[model samples]
Target: MKSFRLFLIASLIFITNNFLFSQEEDVVEDSTETLEVYLIDNYLQGENEKILVLSWMTNLPTKSKVKIEEIGTFNVSDTLTDFHQTKIDLSNVRFTKNEYMFKIISELEDGSSVESEEYSFLVPFEEKDTSSTKSTTTSQQVKTSSSYYIYNFALGITLWLLPSPALAFENNKTKFAILKDLPLVSIGSFSAYKTFPYVYFYAGYVHIPEGFVKNSFRLGTKYLYELPEIKHFVSLGLGGFTNFKGSNGINGEIGFSFLKVLKTFEMTASYSYNYLPSSKNKFHLFSIGLFTSSFSINLNY
Candidate 1:
């Protein structure tokens, strides 16, 4: 009877001590604050003042600064903190046509540091003739686009005569690479190439892509150009292939194109070259296919 009573007393004491400790731990955890700084307000003010107001909120008192990374950490400026607002006085560097990029760095009194996201602001030039400036900008944008791209379409064929591994300069080997020659009925012999806002299909075989498939398919887009007066078009494209003779290699196509005006049916007859830099075998393909006129548009803002 005496032993049973002592055991019961010890059990009660143990339970009480554990409960008290657990409650104390919970209190300590709840007292800890989360380290966070949120940019609640950002704006510019004052012609004479030329001040930038970046207001932020935090759960604890913090010593804060800004880090500007143009090439490296070029500037670290102190902030005038009042409650939540940080006043950046632009009195030193008044009117300039340079964009200022900055990130907020805050160190709490609790020895924890937090960094805000990088932000940028630029003061656009004060133009004399805003309307003429707009017109010139629009014309320049159009000229830039036309210089880079022209709409053209063609039907073409590709041949995979040479097989090579898709090995980069590194020593690692490609996973899905194959060796030896494949019959004429291979994937790369036929392919459907598409671009923005248009779809075209091919009865040709789909080309086995090397290195990267997305990069290979988009190579055609870069080559699109048309001489609308003569209905003549030309394209130059290249793509990588995997499992080419148990290795990876690239293939290229050069297309001479034509389009029927009224119907606008596109056609391309291309000469394709397939070779492996590491191997001696070379393959040539003669391909012709029908497609639609390439589409292009220009935008001004």
Candidate 2:
């Protein structure tokens, strides 16, 4: 009876070992299986404000990212999902009329990744006026042909506010800046403009102080004309200033704009004459600054 018991115990141990070995083999096989993620459909869409939308469907749920040719990879989905949609903000994109190659990569749960076939599309033509014409190219027209207005806002850092005791570009006893803590003077300005094909109508406000002049507030309007193809502009403006001291004046300005640096940043210089007829005092102001309109939006008619 003891011998029989020993035989039964040995048989049980062998059976248990075989069972464990089979489970290990099954797990290894499952892990080594091929990843079968694939795209069922994929397409790109265009929107206003230079936005590009990409949408795709995968056969299996998986995390995915899109890889654009010039741009880097952008995440489309973090969690497992078969459907993916992502918007690419290309307002800052510098290249125009260039083709971009892109692909989607999906990562599966089994530590393997699959990539969809490559696709290509061209950027809208730079010279093509989306506001006035239709595009037959791959890029879609964001606005209708009837749309004739483009709205923009600009904020500038005044490098020098030279309230010269005389004319344009003349040096003064006191100069002000938005960045520096110069004595008795600091300056800031913001403006909004609406553009037609070649002209701009603008309104702006300026902040002054007693140190510069008693008025402390300057409001204005400008009529600007673009110099064809050269990326330069000139403007004439008329406005007024008033403050608590009951001191007030009417101001007029002549301004020039340099080319838009990198299609975003702009440099401007202007000269203004402030005449306080009541006080019989006149001030000449010249300013140079860098301006940006990264947040500017174009309004369509």
What lDDT would each prediction earn against the true structure?
Answer: 0.47, 0.57
Model 1: per-residue Cα lDDT over 3-32, one tens digit each:
999999999999999999999999999998
Best by lDDT: 2
TM-score per candidate? 0.29, 0.36
Model 1, C-alpha of 10: deviation from truth (Å): 2.8
Candidate topping TM-score? 2
